[model samples]
Target chain A: MKWTKRQRQPKLKEHIKEDPFVTDEALAALFEVSVQTIRLDRLEMNIPEVRERIKDVAQKQYDPVKALPEEEIIGEIVDLELDKYAISIMDIKKEHVFSRNSIARGHHIFAQANSLAVAVINDQLALTAHADISFKRQVSEGERVIAKAKVLEIGTLRTKVKIESFVEQSLVFEGMFSMFREEKKIKEE
Target chain B: MKWTKRQRQPKLKEHIKEDPFVTDEALAALFEVSVQTIRLDRLEMNIPEVRERIKDVAQKQYDPVKALPEEEIIGEIVDLELDKYAISIMDIKKEHVFSRNSIARGHHIFAQANSLAVAVINDQLALTAHADISFKRQVSEGERVIAKAKVLEIGTLRTKVKIESFVEQSLVFEGMFSMFREEKKIKEE
Candidate 1:
């Protein structure tokens, strides 16, 4: 089936969304277009390269801010749904390690989890009231940590969030955060 | 009161203990010795210089390890009394800051507090079960953070610890940790 440029672009976005890890070559074959055409469409559509696509998919998935400003979040939140779930990714670099050893510091790991816990709450203001956490293993420099925060329970004044961080498939850190949130106000008619 | 060299050395140690921040010149004046003699006495006693003395005072205040190995603590613990209180110090260097901005990352601060919280537990095995923490201010490169942990309550299987971090006199971070600890065992007669 021959497809015009206008028709293919929207489909390309949808195709990539369904599988963010899909390679450009595979996308070109599926779209029945030249590789160059696929590349141009992606560029015009402002889609990032495939590697970044894995981490960037969350950018468009949901509204990022409710409890705190986006800039205040420790990691780039790749996916979010307030008072439900959220995901963020952080790259460990030279600056995040101890000079004597290249292992990423533990607090860096905690900050990512703690911030994600705060970000997933559905209130205008959320403060962490308590947390229980463990370091499962050490993460080294050059590793990327993906932290997922899931809301366990919600109440008028508090929410419980469970956060687990992984380097690839390995669990590097885990925590449970009890967050204090301002009560949701009733809207005027 | 003419004190012999042997008598004066013990007194010097006592004086320094009373005030770890005492100047070498003050020690000389108090001990009725020349400044060079005071320096020699301090060196012979293996005392660190005054600048380091303030941060190092905790080294002699308590037994350092109960829950975890001393080396595993994120900051250099200078004071500790397991299940009671502890203090640690960390110097923020280039390696601990963001490359783009010199502000120390939030996790570094959290790690210091978390580790201190764990260190203060009076058990052979202690794990952080939960924490509620907040970063009060941004810490910059070259700043030194002092973290103090105090035990709030003790339970047969769980303990609560409160931790606070300061850069000099300014509060930088604070946290409350609920820790899980192995229960004490009774010795067989």
Candidate 2:
């Protein structure tokens, strides 16, 4: 619905707060306003552009988490449920492997899997006690590795986590991880 | 030996080329000149600051080796020899690990190893066929991981590489990588 500028300005601020990465162009279409109007509204609200907003969030929100710091997770956590399941995505880059092979080095795949595994643990301190891991297939450079980690068992001092990393539908790596949870508090989500 | 203004200018240029990360203070100390003079010399030579030089080099030298670009390698390549050995150093930061644990994400440590492994391969097409890997200890954030990769065996189509990652001489992770050399060229070293 086409809303008045007075009404649209307030809505714009709220939308940006909800998703900082929301584009001005998209907001223009959503609010039925010109791009200039949206930019003006953002300037009036003292809100930076989408790129700056992301950088601001990265700097501010990359704080300590329940299990670890936000930034140290191999890939950004797109979804999470503590002690249950978690997912992360990493864009394989040229730096991730040998220039000759163009395939992602094994550990890059492992990093994505391992971090997602640790993040799913509900604790302040989660350390890898042991892991039975293997590379199932070769992952090429530039392929995105989507790692999904599931909690298999939650014991007194240890948790069994299973991680399977894939490029699209193809599985690249899998691991059965034993995580040691130190100082576990009885918290439920 | 201390060099004068006339002699120092050329040497300063050479030093920056050798190590773009060289500090202005270090250059000043080496040439027995003020920091301002170093800046002036840099300005006169049309060279940017250390940070800018690094960015420039990253942009230029990070060529697509095979699958990934050179710049994406986790740490600076302090030393390298194709199909032989490679050494890299990574400074752990809050950005690289879980905040609460302060331990680096496994992949980061793995990245240091994997990148070094790829780097040590002589072929222009080096791919990790398989890796038997293990983590020996937890590496906390703010520690440096020195990854050293050595070629265990070089075959006609594959090279067996061994990567050991350490923090202050204490082993953290070890892996035996079987890298596939898809196309081997008889290039002189």
Q: What is the DockQ of each candidate?
A: 0.22, 0.22
TM-score of each: 0.51, 0.55
Whole-structure CA lDDT of model 1: 0.78
- Model 1: per-residue lDDT, tens digit, B35-141? 89988988999987766896666555677577666877888888888888988888899866655457676667777887888788877656666666766777889
Give the clash count for model 2: 20
In candidate 1, position B102 carries an lDDT of: 76
- Counting clashing residue pairs in each candidate, in order, gives 11, 20
Q: By TM-score, how accurate is candidate 2?
A: 0.55
Which regions of candidate 1 deviate over 4 angstroms? Answer: A1-51, A184-189, B1-85, B89-109, B115-146, B149-189
What would the DockQ be for model 2? Answer: 0.22
Which window of 10 residues has the lowest lDDT sum in candidate 2 chain B?
A: B60-69
lDDT of 2 at A159: 90
